[model samples]
Target: MANDAIPVRTERAMMRREDNPFTFLQQEIDRLFDGFGRSFPAFAPPQAMMPRMDVSETDKTIEISAELPGLETKDVQLSLADNTLTIRGEKKSEREEQDKDYHLIERSFGAFSRSVALPEGVKAEDVSAEIAKGVLKVTVKKPAPKQSRQIDIKTAA
Candidate 1:
């Protein structure tokens, strides 16, 4: 009985690593999307997904600038964590028109989020954000570099 079980165990151990359950599922999903896109090209997105951003750093501060067109100061929010910064915005727009011959109305809204990883020296508490002309700028002061101290230990005489 033991000799018969050994061959089955060996065959099971010979399974390929790429045959992992999650990886197999991902490959199947990718294949489905490939075929679906060939059948219907309109399902593709019309525009880019997220807003464009620029990140720069100076001697004492780091700056992040994002281009958010048609957004006001109150439409965006910022948050910071350990070496990570997050920006979220809600774009709510509305329009109305009336005339003797015709009338029309339009409204649209969406929410977007972007997260960035900052350098090691940034200070979250000193971060600040400002919006001007549809551009959002965030500044974070760089903390002073940490110094290492050596401790001395004495043995009993």
Candidate 2:
């Protein structure tokens, strides 16, 4: 029985130190968004799922991608206005079975909407969206950089 006992290592494990400011800011932002949906309790859905999305940008274009599993292009609607891009969709599922002793029925429905604020000069015509294999990808062609000019400062008399 003594031979079967395992050895105990007592050395303290190294703890990873993360950048706290960024982490705290991220946590605060997440809390804000989490509360946003529930703020209007009367209109909140019983079941709502927010899709995970990623946004990236380069010199020429801005790209956005969202993971929307079990959803198709027809089920989603995209609109751009006032430099804001919005994605809205509804998911519905129903199952029914009836035979001899019992009848079982299940139903689920949910709607979700998310919007992203684009930078200035992003035109609606320059944006394109496509969904493939449960992933929605949107690309916005960035407009040419405008030349900056200095304005003379005037002092009030």
Candidate 3:
């Protein structure tokens, strides 16, 4: 029994040593590099996901508004299929003059697609989408409810 206890304690001590802060950090760094290698064969850092989206819903409809600065309406596309609404677009920036140098280019210029699941009982035929002022708005209307009929009960004499 004592011999068994000794091995268990030794294993716990070894695990504690392996879990040291420096060792954990080194393991995390190795894991990150390994993930990067798997994700990017050319050893390039992974790009970040797009920013958050703003969605609004009312009793009658759902409205999705996305801020896409420097993007034209021609560059955007909206579609609905299989109860999923997808918004795809691209942002391209061109130099106005060849002699001018761009000191900073923080805006992203790439294709992006965002999809949202449509709720049940939504009227897909009544969906409307619009883009204005660099903001894309999608509206999906809810199905109209069935009208209820009043029932009158006769009083017993």
Candidate 4:
């Protein structure tokens, strides 16, 4: 009896699809930014370094907390102006290892800026910030509600 060999098929690497100008442009732009990120160690891609945040509001205060692991108070800046609360910071870290056969050093750096628009009547003096255990806490005191006063009509002079 003669043994028959089974046929095996292999697929090609390229798949056929309709050419799209917009897709091509988008892909090119993405590649550009990716290459730029790889070339510059100090600059991170957009939204890459955005810290996780939690915001809460009560009758008298708006509290915000951001998780900024490995960051210290000196590395962060907080400001309020024009009814906007801005948080800015730069993170720099380095690690070094030395052995008899090999020596290695690694560094990482990135900057981040985030802003939150405060509700009308929130003043800079009413805001406070504190940092501890790699977490940033911000408190905004809401302004007291103004009472409407009735005005009396005057006769023409």
Candidate 5:
């Protein structure tokens, strides 16, 4: 049997889609910020050190997942108010060795905060948070869906 296979074209590293002006502008802006971060690490915003988060919504609940590395539950704090969930935590460095030669200190040890807007129906009082491994999960209960009703029309007599 003869082998017959067609070659599939794949995107190259240099072939980026920058036709949209906004996309180009966004890329340029991101590059500018990257330069700033590399140049002035200490001047970076506290929120930049905050862990990244993802939010998802369902019919009756809102769930949020955050990547919080090297943090115990005691080191983290959370609060919710006015339909906004605020996450606060500090990454502390424990250097117990006094005579050990230090070569590099790249770990970040500072307080960081992040706030997330809750959906319309979320109940602030009915919220729960859990920390497992290096991830933090938050769940907020939303109001129940309204029941539909029908009304009969009456003729004027």
Candidate 6:
């Protein structure tokens, strides 16, 4: 009898057309609130979306830095309220010459606001902010905790 080898084949996985949960949820919510604009058209105003931020913290202080290129110090606003720090700003572009036509305007403009929660020990009063070279830097000092004294217990005879 002649020996014969059997061939084995591997199957490839089929690509699935699954909808992302976040996108689907957003679409559904938009559909549900489609008539909201019609009911309160006057309440709606054209507003730009908030920019993303990067926050960092240390034992002594918290540091918040945001990218705000082409924005001057006068254009940015920094405030702290109820343990929340907010940074708001607007980017404006003006044509230097009226005769010059802009071929492309890809740069983003308009108002942007971002807020971050201050840590438990942060001192709001001691917070400091500065804008240098188009970057906004905010430093908040951490409050020192009160030291607790050790209590020794004595046994009664």
Indicate which candidate wins on lDDT: 4
lDDT computed for candidate 5? 0.81
Q: List the residue pairs that clash in candidate 6.
A: none
lDDT of 6 by residue, 96-128 (tens): 555555544445567878888876666567899
For candidate 6, give the lDDT of residue 151: 100
Query: Candidate 1 at residue 18, lDDT?
Result: 93
The lowest-lDDT stretch of 10 consecutive residues in candidate 4 is 9-18
Descending-lDDT candidate ranking: 4, 5, 2, 1, 6, 3
- Clash pairs for candidate 2: none
Q: Which scores better on lDDT, 2 or 6? A: 2
Q: Can you write out model 2's per-residue Cα lDDT over 31-103, one digit (the tens) per residue?
A: 9888865765434455446777999999899999987887899899999988899998987665566576965
Q: After superposition, how far is residue 24 of candidate 3 from its true place, in Å?
A: 5.2
Cα error, residue 56 of model 5, in Å, equals 1.0
How well is each residue in 104-157 modelled by candidate 5, as lDDT tens digits? 455667888889987556565789999999899999998677789899999999
lDDT of model 4 at residue 138? 99
RMSD, every candidate, angstroms: 9.7, 13.8, 6.7, 11.0, 12.4, 11.5
Candidate 1 per-residue lDDT over residues 82-106, each given as its tens digit: 7889998887655556566864322
Candidate 1 off by > 4 Å:
1-49, 95-109, 120-123
Highest TM-score: give the candidate number.
Answer: 4
For model 5, which pairs clash?
Answer: none
lDDT of 6 at 1: 25
Give a tens-digit lDDT track for model 4, residues 1-157.
Answer: 2454864443432433336566788888999998875566556556767887899999999999998888998899999888889999998856556566864323345788898888888888899999999899999999888889999999999
- TM-score between candidate 4 and the true structure: 0.64
Indicate the residue-level lDDT of 81 in model 4.
86
- Candidate 3 lDDT score relative to the true structure: 0.71
